[model samples]
Target: MRFIRTRTAKATAATLVTVPLALGGLAAQSHAQDASPSPSGTFGPGCSALAQKANTAKDKVVEAAAAYPQLSHLVSATVRAKLSGALDGKPNVTIFAPNDQAFQQASASQLASLLSNQGQLKKVLTYHIVAKQITPDALAKGSFTTVEGGKLTTSGSGTEFKVNGKAKIVCGNIKAANATIYVIDAVLRPPS
Candidate 1:
């Protein structure tokens, strides 16, 4: 009986020690997960230029884009498309904004024709936006529907990403009051 008691006590003692150690490992893992950094702030190569040119984190999407001189043409196009209110009013969104250089990439007549038609202009502009704010991590291998209801796919990892397998994200993960802006090197067109 004493031997049985001793064996039972040893088992109980081993369980006590083992249980706490197992729990401690789980606690450490939980803490590590809790401590892992969430995606935040801005990223990409053009961020340096953006830092030198503007700080629009506190402004609304339209106004934030306006703050960057590189985005002047995009801002103008957004206003002309009558999308300023829509973009500014969104609680959360992702804007794949094309810089002025991207606008210049289009033929003069093509740009003029699109601008002259409000419906087409709005469709083109909205094609650059996603309803949900997307992070750089998600931007890698992302397939999202745009506000224009056309699908856009993103590829590449780290700071380099492309839209529709073409437009390179120049400056990405930029924060605004209502949106996150990723400045792209080319305008994205919606599917007809």
Candidate 2:
């Protein structure tokens, strides 16, 4: 009886230890799979600042962009260029919108010049847009034609990408009613 009890206790202890070890291994494996990048949904560091809301997805491109404070400069520029009507009418598009800091990066004179000339402002602004909605995967090694009729290339893996080999996409995969917006760190210029 004593021997049987000793063996039973030993077996129970071993089972307890083994079960947790096995479960822990399984938990670790599951966590690793979760850590892998997901192709769907928004990406990039700047995405953290974005307020995730269902209403944003329902709003039109111009209206959706207006909700984000960081995109105020872009919205203002688009309105000033009289592009709100045209952009709102588009069924699908990809906009590499520059943040306020990007505009500040340009010389005051350059910004003044661009903003003052409607034709030039329209050209420069249109260059930042593509006629189709682009996904993060497509952005990896892409050469797309801009709305301005200029060609721009994007390259990089995962969440990092650049436009025209210059402007880095600060935040990507943002959805609007008729557009996918990738907020870039610099303004893109069309080929003259």
Candidate 3:
């Protein structure tokens, strides 16, 4: 899918790259904008944390998720969506995985219907991922492209981040061979 760069994305990219050099060769400090807070505390709600222990740099997204019981539901969804291989690649990826509790909150009929439609399921599942390797600082606030060709917005800093102002990150920065995983509390729906 082609990515349509949003205005917010452009602004963020400019900020990320425009580190102006100063007399001391350090990036100039400005009072108008603030940097992201230092990383600390738990990344999310912590249904079962993988950040503290997950360091499977040789495993793909699917392989990594399969190793954690807390991520079992997400693994099943990815499998059903036929997106397991899609998440394994050279491109850096970030997945906002929703825990089992998030899935349990959904209606039975909705999930059943989604699973039956391969295309729809793929779209929904891909919306939970970003095409870039987003770090905690970058997730402070910005718009980004998803593998499903959707626009995702994030806000907050440190351990208090939210996706599209809806889903809260439960456990973040879990390393996979090809992707970074951030477990969220709610499932993110794609735009119709």
Candidate 4:
């Protein structure tokens, strides 16, 4: 069974095509319409780091993520899930990528278990990715759907949006060639 949020038209063109194996992974906002929503409030520690490349960027989603040392584990997880094409090739994706330290805090056994199963890994990773672009303004209210077919509820305003009522959007509104990225401090787990 699949779970989806009560929302409208978050997915448009992409269906996560896979010729070999289906993989998953995790964007920021940069556009006249993709506003930051918060100018004075501070978010997570990585905000400054993300801001440095938040705008005036030309790299693709995955490529841009790979540039951030903090997102190394997320990039690796995406590669492991064989989701490079979905993220790198597709457009208008929004990713709530968890930093490396988030994974580092997971139980060694849990990490090992996910790494061992591609299907399970895909579901977990996709839970963090939305099929459509999500701006900080849009995130100010309502729920959203993940490619994994799960519900991600957002509350709070500006740079304080939280995912699943737990994971905080530390760095957000980052624009990439094919996606928007929100760096979160926690990795969102899909319902069993």
lDDT of 3 by residue, 1-192 (tens): 134567778888887666553432443455312444343322554734443335466788888888777678788988888788778864679888888778887899988888789998888998988988888778888799988898999888756789999888877777777888878888889998
Off by over 4 Å in 3: 1-42, 47-54
Off by over 4 Å in 4: 1-45, 49-56
For model 2, state the Cα shift of residue 160 in Å.
Answer: 0.9
Per-residue lDDT, model 3, residue 1, is 17
For TM-score, the strongest prediction is: 2
If both were scored by TM-score, which would come out higher, candidate 1 or candidate 3? 1
Error of 2 at 114 (Å): 0.9
- Residue 184's C-alpha lDDT in candidate 4? 88
Q: Locate the minimum summed-lDDT window of 10 residues in model 4.
A: 19-28
Model 2 scores a C-alpha lDDT of 0.87
Q: Write the per-residue lDDT of candidate 1 for residues 16-96, one digit (tens) a residue.
A: 999999999999999864542237856666777764355778899999888888899899989998999989999889999
Writing each residue's lDDT as its tens digit, candidate 4 over 63-148 gives: 88887788898999999999988888777888989988889989999999998899999999999988897767677675998899
- Residue 36 deviation, candidate 1, in Å? 14
Worst 10 residues of 2 by lDDT: 32-41
Better of 2 and 3 by TM-score: 2
lDDT of 3: 0.77
Tell how far residue 180 is off in model 2, in angstroms.
0.3
